[model samples]
Target: MPLPHLLRRRAPRSGARRTARRLAVTVPLVSLAGVLALTGCANRERDAAPGAGTSTTASSAAQTAAFPVQVTVPGTDHAVTVERRPERIVSLAPSSTESLFAIGAGEQVVAVDNQSNYPEQAPRTDLSGYTPNIEAITGYNPDLVIASNDTEQLVASLEKVKVPVLLLPSPHNLDELYAEVTALGKATGHLTEAEDLVRTMRSDIDKIVKDTPKPAKQLTYYHELDPQLYSATSRTFIGQIYGLFGLVNVADAAGGTGDYPQLSPEHVINANPDLVFLADTKCCGQDAAAVAARPGWQSVTAVRDNGVVALNDDIASRWGPRVVDLVRTVSDAVTRTAQQG
Candidate 1:
């Protein structure tokens, strides 16, 4: 129901033209009910290292000295060469903005889109990722532009002006997430810091999964993407995180091919999931009580047993440094529900 969610559900198309299709829709895109079932389409480079539970310390100064780096855009063979360490970077992707800040490239970022709400100190601008404006973005005089998609022929247009652009899409899993972070490191000449951050994130996530208690029976959950009952199946990035705790996704039983599917109220009630994780608290004001109050929802196992977990919408949506926080939140919910059972 929020503007951010509408922006996230981009209309199906190629390149920046997708943004045009999205804006052309006369009616509002609410609850994804009007949109087609869409999965995350971005890709990341291969991981820098193999081990998932290892830790590494990095020297930022030493890494910054390495310049003229070339990074291949994920999902594409196109390689972008950064001639020097970028000093005035413009980030249009929220996840990339968070990754840039986490990998110690924060000082190099001159501006970010309006949606990059984390890190408190991000140089937030009115630049729109959904319907990007080349003139407005170029106004920042960016040496480099980072984006999630090629919305509006952003890459081609930037190339015309000779400004380097890095397109890192939303990753489908943790490995891909790591690769994106690593790629950002190379692009910004902070490869060591990016690799270090990835190692820590892997170690932290592994620990969280290991620390969670196995419930008496396999737990089933419904990940609420919106109050309209749009949910994520286990095939999704969010679902994979839940799967790490051995929790089953109820949406998987709905028999849809898309990672995201809109379910009817009766279907969710019939599934009777053991856990309900609401990612719509901010977007739609949904919480444990809000879910429980739904007609016939009182009969749901999660509602009756207080197994509803409220999640930060942004953290749940983005796969960046804070994904460790998302894992910990799921870990806490799993622990509490296991204990209750």
Candidate 2:
């Protein structure tokens, strides 16, 4: 699980509030046993172009997982010698379900994670690791079970089942995200399509960077996950989006490596950002005003200037086709400043 690091360098302090807001809402709505589900809440684009099996040798792991799934996704990495293609698949995470859907195998997903709610047509299967529903998952007679990793109960439950289980690592950044897409594509006999999609995503991003204003300032932002709000570190997907827009994320002050770091009231007051974007409002639970009235948040530009923006939880957390929307949202937030300049 040695993941690559990718995020902005200097994140805003006050914006750290955004993290809690996001996790609070998204985790419950999409959490598959305390871990965030891919919720199919796409941001509109991924960095890779929208093509699968397009070009460039995939990874050693990618080669090993070579298409036309045989048995099941090995619980281990790159253990691709399965017995058959996953015709009846059950997803334990929303993102895992969404990944299958993205590769044109939506019909194959017989059952979905409890939180899965994208495409508006996923089956209402009673599958969730929260309650340990092995019978429910097995009831679908699935050949493959795509479950989230790092869940003890979920992992243990899958091993007991005779079916093949593909344990996908939770995505921490862009490369991992792409890897997930590619791996899932191979399993579904859609590597070629996945490759194409990734390529198209990259091309689109290149265009965004080439066409957008490139003043050294980048965009300065404060992203909140909740009303009390924690912010993302310089190495998270949300943080990376700000980087893609050349926006300076001020959360780095409180952000850690893998996710948004918790911010103290003192820290929020000290490193106020230009704009504030709150993620996943469900976590706020009627706490925005109360959180807003807290000691030092009022001093931050987002609070004072009323620049705080509540984001769409579905599109912001999923990292699906909608990743571009997140970028666009960030772009618009920063564009306001560009216009004033």
Candidate 3:
């Protein structure tokens, strides 16, 4: 999902910078051993269908450790102490909304931002996560607020009123994703459930990778963030998922600033990626035909071979439980491409 225009265009304040630095110090990087463990679990699950035998057990011991848990909110200097399991929660970001629901914290979610349109039962209100109103948010009397970005103004406003906020920025990699999920679980008294969810996601994603056959030659891919030619780099979380399949990112050479960079149409034509994954199918109405009709895009291999994959804009953009579904969709596309060869 593209960030709300307000967040994407606004410059970060000094306080936000300091908060980001604190997160860097507090959250340890995932170890190689941990990665291997996840991979091992994934391989086992691959032998069965994904989600067929998944377990959902919350350890009694873990529930005891949930309260009064103090965690350094990622991208914030302030460590929030959850005095008790939050009963009235507000999700400012769509990803956070999905995470809360996935970990069985949905019942505690009193309300969610306007952009949180998933799960069919989330309390969607007119609240704007991007341009949050302190008065409107406080009206709900939420004990906890979860958000993706920590804009200085928004954070200060909520803190002023004594509402605990968990600022979880878009994760750079899968390890960071796990940490975020774990933190949310501990904060909401769902630590065991969160751990289980993470394990399942890891297993399912790895299964997709394991089942996908390596192409005869390295495949080049273009992931379209919008019809305007914006794209994610190999270093971004979205790119890392595609990287798992050994697909080279065509946008890497653009050297675009930030995670997302806009590419010129001509540059994309010159690269001529083997596969095109359109994350803007819903947002921009882009499809294989739409891409082929673009001036100078008819010659692209992906278009010519009908290898353009239309994706759910929300799933592609949000780093949440449904990320596994995105991986499965991409894996299927890759399998088809390899078979055609």
Worst 10 residues of 3 by lDDT: 24-33
Report each candidate's C-alpha RMSD, comma-separated, in the order given: 8.9, 8.5, 8.1
Clashes of each: 3, 69, 1
Flag regions of model 2 displaced more than 4 Å: 1-80, 129-131, 153-156, 215-218, 255-258, 282-298
How well is each residue in 263-341 modelled by candidate 3, as lDDT tens digits? 8898899999999987656545778989999999999999998889997666676666766776777788889889989
Residue 267: error of model 1 in Å?
0.8
Residue 56, candidate 1: alpha-carbon lDDT:
27
Best by TM-score: 1
Which of 1 and 2 is the better model by TM-score?
1
Q: How would you encode candidate 1's per-residue C-alpha lDDT over 106-147 as one tens digit per residue?
A: 878999887777667889988988679999999999999998
Give per-model TM-scores.
Answer: 0.83, 0.73, 0.82
Over the full model, what C-alpha lDDT does candidate 1 score relative to the true structure?
Answer: 0.71
How far off is residue 139 in model 2, in Å? 1.7
Candidate 3 residues lying further than 4 Å off, grouped into runs, are: 1-66, 73-78
> Each candidate: what lDDT?
0.71, 0.55, 0.70
